[model samples]
Target: MRAALGLYLELHAHPELSGAETGTAERFAGHLEGDGATVTRGIGGHGVVGVLRNGPGPTLLVRAELDALPITERTGLAYASTVPGTMHACGHDLHLASAAGAFALLAAEPDTWNGTLLVVGQPAEETLEGADAMLADGLYERFGTPDTVLAQHTAPLPAGTLAHGRGPMMAASAALDVVIHGRGGHAGTPQLTVDPVVTAAATVMRLQTVVSRETAPSDQVVLTVGSLRAGSRGNVVPDEAELSITVRAATDQALERAVEAATRIVRAECAASGCPEDPDVTLVSRSPALLPDPAATAAVRAAHEREFGRHRVLDWPGSMATEDFPRFAVGGVRTAYWMVGTTSPRQWRAAHSAARPVPPNHSAEFAPDVRTALPAGIAAMATAVRQLFKETW
Candidate 1:
């Protein structure tokens, strides 16, 4: 736990963005090597896979993220992010640290459990690309296929708590990059120019209907225009406007419908504005909803209940947050994903008392109660792995 805390602090301070986790990977691989695991680097863009074979048994893979978000830190911690515009707001640092700590525990007591341990530090999880990249690069072919893959994510709930979902664990997501082209003319000549910025603005408004009007009220769907880039100055109208839209839903069908409706809205808005060219709508990335295997999840949930008690462990009412971790479930590998709470007791009470929202994952103020959360997370992961080991594959 102490070692994990140190690594957590170091990782939290020097976070790297998605696809640029070179130094982060080096540090993580180094730590894994220190724990006497055969660490392999450069699997799929800074992805680290450390193989620890402990006799012959069912192979278990524990995965954690290596990259952080692009948000700047505002958590006001002593070990706050040193890199500007990069922060571990998503508790990935905690996840990585817990994986490292759990692997270390397993290594120290090798006699307690059988089989191999595959610890993966995946990169580009923030952009939902790392898992696919690793799989495409032969994650399973290179490393032997595992009987089970286990992972946990941090949530805004009070620290020392674990949440498990019986069915759907997370939402499916699709991100699209759109470009609207318009005829550029003098800004003063409103008659000659077809302004793309106007089209983009209109498209943004119409996109809201994809959820409010089109999607079922019972369904959870979120459509966000995260980025909109247009002209540089007010004087000159740019030839094209760009938009980055991310659509997330509880089901794949809803996600597809929302994305289709969004793209249609963009094209209609561009056409309505009499734009000179057809709009370009490109799929940036997409991830299916995370549905953990029932048997696998049951084993891990029981392990966590034994480790953290029934009160601290609760049923997760599924969330809309999406993850690429599901990609690792390819090739008949059963997977289980759960949530570990991160908010401190004081933070929880204060937020509840004040009736204000606590800073969530991806927020600049998103800081986990690492001292409490990290240890619990490490125990949860280790216990889950150990319990899975005793089960028949």
Candidate 2:
């Protein structure tokens, strides 16, 4: 546990932004090679894949994301990030530690299973590009296309519980960037200027209607305007206004409908506001929903029950958060993604404060309670991987 915590803290102190995990990859690769696993580095722009094949019968792929948010660090911990404008607020440090711990455990007892294990350190999950890069770089073709894939994410749930869902564990997400252009003018001339700020505000309000009125009531959809920037000065009417939106849906059809509705709403709102030109809506990032296979989920649950007792296993409702791990599932392999609790009561209360604003994932203050959560995550993932190899291989 001390060693795991040390690794987590070291990673926390040296957080890297998306697609810039060179040092992180090298550190994990050294550990993997030390444990007798065949390590491959620089596969997908800093992704490291470790293969442990012992007369394989079936292959199992385990993955952990290795990217940090772009927020500045403010946790004030002794091992807080040293980088000026980067932090591992999403607990990726813990994720990597648990992954390495699991690998170490398996390496110490390789005779327990008769198969191949692929441990992947994926980069750029926040930007939703790492999984695509891995696949394009022959992750499946080269690693023998896993029969089952298992991955776990640290969550803010109760400290000892392991949360898993059978189907559609997370929602599909798409980032929308809308740019509205208008004619700029001085504060004194109100009649001649087209106020893009007002137009952008109206567009933001109209975007809410896409989820409420355009989509069906039963369809789970979320349309959020996370950012809006218009003018440089208080009195001047800016020439352009920018709006960033995040859209979530449960299914592909629903996601497509939401995207179409958002495009229509932005165009209509821009026309109604009498903007000189139509707004440009672009998708910055996108990820599909995670649909877990029932058999694979049951196997993982059984492993949790055996290793940590039945009371520790939990059934959770589907989350609206999105993960790129589901892309591996799309390749015809069974996938079960679990949530490992990482928040304590004290941290939860502090995180919810409105004044100081402890932002969740992208916030600088979003540090997981690593001292208590890292070991449980490691044990759960290790037990799941061992059981998967036993059953499949």
Candidate 3:
């Protein structure tokens, strides 16, 4: 517990952005090497991989992210982020520390299980590009293919609770950047030019109907415009307005329908406003929905019940939150990812009693109660991995 807490504090103090996690990678590599594992760095843009072989047994892969968000820290903790405009708001620091602790435990008790463990510290998970980059750079080829892949994330549930399900654990996601072009003109003149500001407003309103009217009520879909940029000054109209949107769905077909509907609405709105050209809709950072193998999930869930008891281990529904962890299952390897609660019991009770909202993951005020979460995370992860090995044995 002491070792994991110390590592978590150090990581939280010095948060790094995605694809720029040089120092974070070094720290993870150091921990892995210290545990007598063969370490490799720079796999796919600051990614680190550690391999430990105990005998002729099935290989299991465990992954942890090594990047932070661009938000500033507002938790006011003693070990808050020192880097400006960057924070571990998503609890990747907790993930790293827990994985490191699990690795250390396995190294210390070599006879507990006999299997090759591959620990991956991946970069750029926030942008949803890191997992593919590492795989393209030959992650499996260098480390050998694994029988199962395991990962977990932090959630707002009460600390010491574990959650998982059979299918669609996380949503498939796409990032869309749309540029609406118009002729610049004076704001005072009403009839002088095509007003893209008005067009962008209409586009936003119309997008809300795509999910409500166009798609079936049974299907789950979410389209959010996170960023918008228009004219620089209020007096003069700008030539173009830009919008950043994110789309998510439980299935690929539904995701495609949502994207198509969004593009059509953007183009039709721009055309109706008499713009010079159609709005440009560019899609990037595409990720498939995460569907864990049912058999693998069952085995891991049973392991958790044994380790933490049935009361602490809860059945979870699929979440709309998306991640790049599913990319590692591209080659048909069985994968299972779970979520562990980070909020303390006191905070959870206060939120309900005081009517105060709990700080969710990716919020600036999201400071995980590491005192309780870290130990549970380590135990749950290590127990799951050991269960996989025991089944193979």
Candidate 4:
């Protein structure tokens, strides 16, 4: 556990942003090979797959994300981020370390399970494009698709608790970028300009209605305008304004309706405000929602109860967070996404600041209490892998 913590901290100190995780992938590959697993590098940009086969019955794949956020570091720790503009604000460092630790434990005790293990270091999860790239590059066909897929994400729950949900563990996420165009002029002579800033603001307010009035109350839809940019000066009216949005929904139908409603609102608002021709609403990227398999959840729950006792495993609500791991479900494989808690009371208090907002996963100040979280994560993944292989084949 100390060795795992040391490795995790080292990864936390030297963080890499999405799509630029060359060094991180190489280091993980080295560790995997050191543990007697056959390591494959450069699968999907910077993905590393470690194979450990022992007279396989069914192949079990365990995945861990390996990219950090683009926020500047402010943690002020001794092993702080060396990179200026990137940090492991999302606990991917712990995810990588825990997966490696689980691989180590399983490699040492291969006789405990009777199948192959594929521990994968996936990249570009922050951008939600890595898994697609891996699959396109033959992740499944090249290395024999697994019978079941297992992955875990750390959360803000208690230090040593494991949380699991049966179905719809995470919502699907789509990045919506709306560009509102209009004529520009001086702020004082507002009659001459169309003022896209006002139109953009109105559109932002109207977007809120998509989830509230458009979707059903139980649909679980989230439409957030994360960023809005328009004017550069107080006196001058900008020609165009842009809004970056994140749309989430529990089901695909709800997601489609949200997108359609948002597009209609943007068009209607631009026309009603008498702006230029029309507003451009485009989807930047998208990831499908993760729906957990009942059998997989039951297997994980039983395994958690056996390994950490029934008291440690707890029922959890579905998270609004998005994951691309659901793509694996397309080929008829069961998936389980677990939440490992990383927050402490001190950390929670620090997170309440309005100025800093307690540094969530994408913030540079976001850091996990690895010493308490890594072991449980490792144990959970290992137990899931063992149980999944044993029950299926």
Candidate 5:
């Protein structure tokens, strides 16, 4: 536990961005090596795979992310992010530490369970590219396919609790990159310039109607204009405006409709502005909704009931958060994903009494209470794996 906490502090202090996790990969791989795992590096971009085989039985794979968000840290903790513009605000550092601790516990008690344990440190999860990259790089072909794949994420609930979804767990999402073109000219000559900056701002405002007016209220959809960049100086109008959008929906049909509406809005806004050319809308990445296997989920849920009392185990209604984990479910592979509580009891009480929400993932103020969450995550994971080995299916 002490070693795991130390590693957690180190990772939190120095977090790497997606697709640029070389040093992070080295540290994770080195820890796996210390635990006697046969380590493999660079499966995808900076992905690390550790293998521990003890007499052949069922193979179980545990996944933990290795990348951090681009947000700067605002948590005044002593081990807050050292980087000026990067922080592990999403609790991936905690995820990695818990995974490492679980492996260590299992490795020390080899006689208690028998099988192959594959601890995966997957990179680039934030950009929704790591899982696909690993699959394209022959992840399953090189490493033996496991009978069950397990992963857990952190949430703002009280620590020492776990949540499992009965059916759907996460949303299907897509990323769209748009570039709006216009005629650039001096700010004084407003009549001569098309002013893409104005068009971009107008389009952003108009896009809100896609959800509030266009889509059904019952059908969940989230469209966020995450990035928008235009002119360099206030005195000049830029030639082009770029916007990056992310759309997430409960179903594939809803997702398609939302994307189409967004595209239509952008093109119409450009046409109305009389820009030089049609706007460019490119699909960056798309991932289907994450629906965990029913039987596998049940097995893990039961394991959680045993590890942490039934009162601590709750049913997750579902979330709109997007993940690329469904990409690994190709070819009929059984996978289970759950949520672990990261908030301390005091934090929960304060939020409830104040009628305010706790800081969420990707927030600069978000930080997991390691003293309580770390041990629970480790036990929940190790016990889940041990239970899966004992299940019939």
Candidate 6:
């Protein structure tokens, strides 16, 4: 726990953005190396892997994301992010520290278990490209393939609580970059210009129907227009307006339908406004839905329950959030990814009672109670890894 806290403070103070986590990867690799594990650095764009061989047994891989979000730190903690536009708002710092602590603990107690512990510090998780990049660079071939893979993410639930999902853990997601084109003119000559700003606004409003009307009510889908940019000055009408939309769904079919509908709507809306060209819709990033192996999830959950009492462990429902962690299981390897609570009990109670919104994972104000969460996260991960070694070790 002491080790984890120190590492967490250091990581939180200097967060790095996705795809540029060279120093973060170095720090993680150094932490693992200090624990006597053989470390490998720069496996597919700053990905670090630490392998600890104890004896002849099953190989287990534990992964932690090393990249931080682009949001600036709003929390006034002493260890707040020094980088202006980078913050560990999604708790990757906690994840990295906990994974390192787990590695350190397992490495120290060599007799407690016997197997190969593969600790992975994955980069670019925020953009859903890290796991794919690692795989493309031959992560499994370079290091031995694992029999079981495990990972954990931070949640807004109260600290000291652990949550697990039996099947679908997180939704599949896709990002869309849509550029709506129009004729540029002065604001006074509205009759001569094909206004893309108006069309973009219309598209945003109509996108709600894609989820509410087009999709089945029983099925889940989310279409969010995160950014819409147009002219800077009020007097000048821009020639083009750009929008960035994110779509998430429980299944691939739903995701496809949502994107199709979104694109069709954007094109139709622009054409209806007498635009000259068709809208340019680009799929920026795509990630598959995360479905933890049911049996593996059960075993990990049971281990967590045994380690951190059943009262502290809870069953969690599927979330709209997506992850690339499941990509590690592409070759039929079993995978289990769970969530650890980061909220304090007091804050949880206040949010529920006062109807105040709790700061979620990606929020700039998300300040986790590391004092309680760090130890719990480390213990939970360690227990899960140990459980996977039971049959072999």
Worst 10 residues of 5 by lDDT: 384-393
Model 6: runs farther than 4 Å from truth?
391-393
As for candidate 3, its clashing pairs are none
Question: How does model 3 fare in lDDT?
Answer: 0.92
TM-score of 3: 0.98
Q: Tens digits of per-residue lDDT for model 2 on 266-368?
A: 8988898888988888999888888888888898898898888888778878888887888887557888788887776677676577455434565666767
lDDT of each: 0.92, 0.85, 0.92, 0.86, 0.91, 0.91
TM-score of each: 0.98, 0.93, 0.98, 0.94, 0.96, 0.96
- Encode model 1's per-residue lDDT on 63-114: one tens digit a residue: 9999998898998999999999999989999999999999999999999999
Cα lDDT tens digits for candidate 4, 95-143: 8999999999998897898888899999999889899889888999989
Alpha carbon deviation, residue 111, candidate 3 (Å): 1.0
Candidate 4's TM-score: 0.94
Residue 10 lDDT (model 3): 91
RMSD of each predicted structure: 1.1, 2.5, 1.1, 2.4, 1.5, 1.5
Q: CA shift at 109, candidate 4, in angstroms?
A: 1.0
**Candidate 1 residue pairs in backbone clash:** none
Worst 10 residues of 4 by lDDT: 351-360
Off by over 4 Å in 5: none
- What is the alpha-carbon lDDT of model 5 when measured against the actual structure? 0.91
Off by over 4 Å in 3: none
Task: Give the winner by TM-score: 2 or 6.
Answer: 6
Q: What is the C-alpha local distance difference test score of candidate 1?
A: 0.92
